[model samples]
Target chain A: MTDRAFAVVRAGALTSVQDRGRPGHAHLGVPRSGALDEPARDLANRLVGNPLGAAVLETTLSGCAVRPRCAVTVAVTGAPCRVTVDGRPAAWGAPVRVAAGAVLDVGSAADGVRSYLAFAGGVACEPVLGSRSTDLLSGLGPAPLTHGTVLPLGPVAGPPVYADAVPWQGPPRELVLRAGPGPRTDWFTARALRTLVTAVYRVSPAGNRIGLRTEGPPLERAVDGELPSEGMVLGAVQVPPDGRPVVFLADHPTTGGYPVIAVVKERDLAAAAQAAPGTPLRFVLTERR
Target chain B: MSTMRVLPAGDRALLVELGSGEEAEAFHAELLRRRARGTLPAVREIVPAARTVLLDGLDDPARFAKGLADWEIPALVSGAGSTVELPVRYDGPDLAAVAELWGVPAGEVGRIHARTPFRVAFCGFAPGFGYLTGLAERYAVPRRSTPRTAVPAGAVALAGAYTGVYPRSSPGGWQLIGSTDAVLWDHARVPAALLTPGTRVRFVPEEG
Candidate 1:
């Protein structure tokens, strides 16, 4: 009822409210569903003078459009895109003030698969287990934004902070990851490990928030039987019956029946988030102990 | 031999391997006890499974992995964890099939299952679905060769050496023998899942 809210004008492909996400609940089968690009969300918050962990809008592929009910300061980061205020062009990675009822259009991503938008006051939605992130797997938090959806805004804590520039890391053309040893590495054949690091892979269209399914040479296994469902961790490179490695993402299940060949370093996962389907990928496997 | 080993899961987690599910349950208990007593490092989640326990969100997993070999895990703390009694109806399509597998009368399956106490070895497949272990290895049953497209929620099922109630409708290969009315998971509820690892489960037969 209050005027401190915005109405969705264009919901784009997939847009959801996300924060740092509800972690530490994996034992109860909750996935750590946070913004894939944590740094991008942090930068967007900094420009809008919101807390680093404040909830922001994460838009996939093409961006979104919104009309605020009140005057607000906003910023956009992650995957460079054409941002426009009403009919005029606006800054892409910097703060921009918009009048009440003005349409803020976030156009198709120029280079990345996702873009982040932050308001001076973060999106104030009902938090579930200490997060507002929409978990696609568990169906927690608010549902994905639809056209005409009204989202409440929290009270602004401070004025917008203007910086000289916020560096934008372009989306990865060739997604390279630093992989480490696994808990179930012995499940694979000795030659499998060698094939894993040397094989050329591409991001399959089947990739999602749960995992990045790879299309590559199948890793041969020493053990043919399925694992007795074991606890899985973030960044685990789980190989199914088919042998293609799947890199677990934020929304991955806590346990799986597949054997993990290796684990991708946490630092490199941000680039994986923006990798479009068919992006070439290489694994630089670390020494096995 | 009480075999135990630890493997590093990237930089943030360590997977402790045990010889059996019972050992995993005991080790998970030790980890929880240490966590409560402030002896263990501040890790996010310590998840148990069939024969492995994952220590996640640790700052330095290698340091913890090195110390695991020296620690002696105690036996499971009897009567320490909460026990849940589930009232189930012995009317499922797979009841006859499961009864045949056990070489018992169809009607006797419910009574036999209700008498034994099952402990949750771990939870996986979906939210709130706990893999309960108690039946001896001799009772291990093979999963359905072709999984049903939709196993209704609350279906009490068996596979291998474990029994579980489906928390939600999902495609599963387990042999179903009954159904329960209890809600296994509710996001609005505190703790969300009704069955967590280390809990004791007792199935009670509902009057037909």
Candidate 2:
């Protein structure tokens, strides 16, 4: 818990501390920047008995190497990463106890994209804007973890409270987003909403924290018009002047001008969060009944 | 005139467009009032734009088009919001260029900025950032053709008829006129945002 100095001996593609992201700040221009793979992060945290939102290491596919300075229990979940402790093979998705100076190595995932390493306590870095998650677009949290970086773990008492290991996998192939209508629906022509559901849109390479730009038949508005810039939310599907549809993701702008064809359901956001580039996405219309 | 137009934004949020810049302002006021009284719905967040308000909660996004028909629209009050005085240095690189464009002395730009209190018309572009309207007609500056990759935190910038403060370090296209020391957001504090939708904000010259 308290007396811990965790250091990154080697970093792979990406490594950043992420807890649950800061929400309800979009009106202030902040995105709900957090773990893109929410389920994995949550599972990893639970394995180590960390608090519900304890900070975990969100390592991209390449993975990372870490050296802990104290006794700890850690687990890696999300994307399938090869994990090992001091040259001994370690099972992924399960907790492992480590003494001081033990080196934990995480390779890359074969099936999925992101892997989160959670500690028994938690990563205790400076919390910015009410969350430990890093917003690379906003510079809201600490920089990405690099080699030779030493991280401090939060305080934990007594024994670890581990959860029964239940393996889970993110949605594969086309992600189905449940949505509702938006402000500029009039901007679209007939069957616009139907097209969103019926048509299969390919995720564009231009996707990022801001939004997921997709390739589909240009959505025709009933009235081709301009919308005054207005407040936007995560999961908002905005159609730009080019006629292509772009679904606002975790780091969406506070406002936008394009007509919204539909919005993704809140519960389904995690599926979209882990979608890699070029993944196909489909839309479905549903009510809260 | 106040008009309610509700539309769905994706499957996540609800967008309500209220006609009249005046009505948008009033709706912001009413939102704060309801929030204070704790009668607001399970809305996670509500954002007010120039003439629209986005509501996000567990509400059915499909039913949003119908929800606007039932909301009690608030009355607009042009100058009724609380006034917050912000101190600025007015030393941004674009200050002189902006003044020259307006055919006035660079120092006068600060005067024009502080001439009247600005209303928080909306928050967009970035987090906790506010789009404060009510700039003097003469000082309305167009946005830079190409935005800077990184604008410093607390930077007070202007674009066209909108004046705004950058809450965090971000890329921006607005003309930076000055900087402020007030912390617009801090995660450690309760109610992280410094300027809510209805709060008034004013700019004052800060000497450092």
- Candidate 2 global TM-score: 0.86
Q: What's the lDDT for all of these models?
A: 0.89, 0.76
Taking the tens digit of each residue's C-alpha lDDT, what string does model 1 give over A1-289?
2499999999999999999998888877778888988889999999999998799999998899999999999999998999999979999899999889999999998897889999988999999989999888777789999999999999997888889878877899899989998878898898999888888899998988889999999999998876888888889999998889999988898888899889999999999999988999999987776
In order, what are the TM-scores of chain A for the candidates? 0.97, 0.88
lDDT of 2 by residue, B88-126 (tens): 878887898888878999989888887767877777776
Q: Please provide, for model 2 over A1-289, each residue's C-alpha lDDT reduced to its tens digit, 9 standing for 90 to 100.
A: 3368798988878788888888877777677778877788888887887777889998865789899999888888887768899988897888888778989998876655578898888999888777888787666787888889988898763355455656675545777777766556666776776687788887776776567778877777787556778877777788888777887766676777776766676677766656666778887767421
Off by more than 4 A, model 2: A157-165, A191-195, A215-226, A241-243, A286-289, B10-12, B59-74, B77-81, B89-92, B95-108, B136-139, B152-155, B167-169, B178-194, B206-208
Chain A agreement with the truth for model 1, given as TM-score: 0.97
The fraction of reference interface contacts (C-alpha pairs within 8 A across chains A and B) present in each candidate is: 0.73, 0.87
Tell me the fnat of candidate 1.
Answer: 0.73
What is the CAPRI rating of model 1's predicted complex?
medium
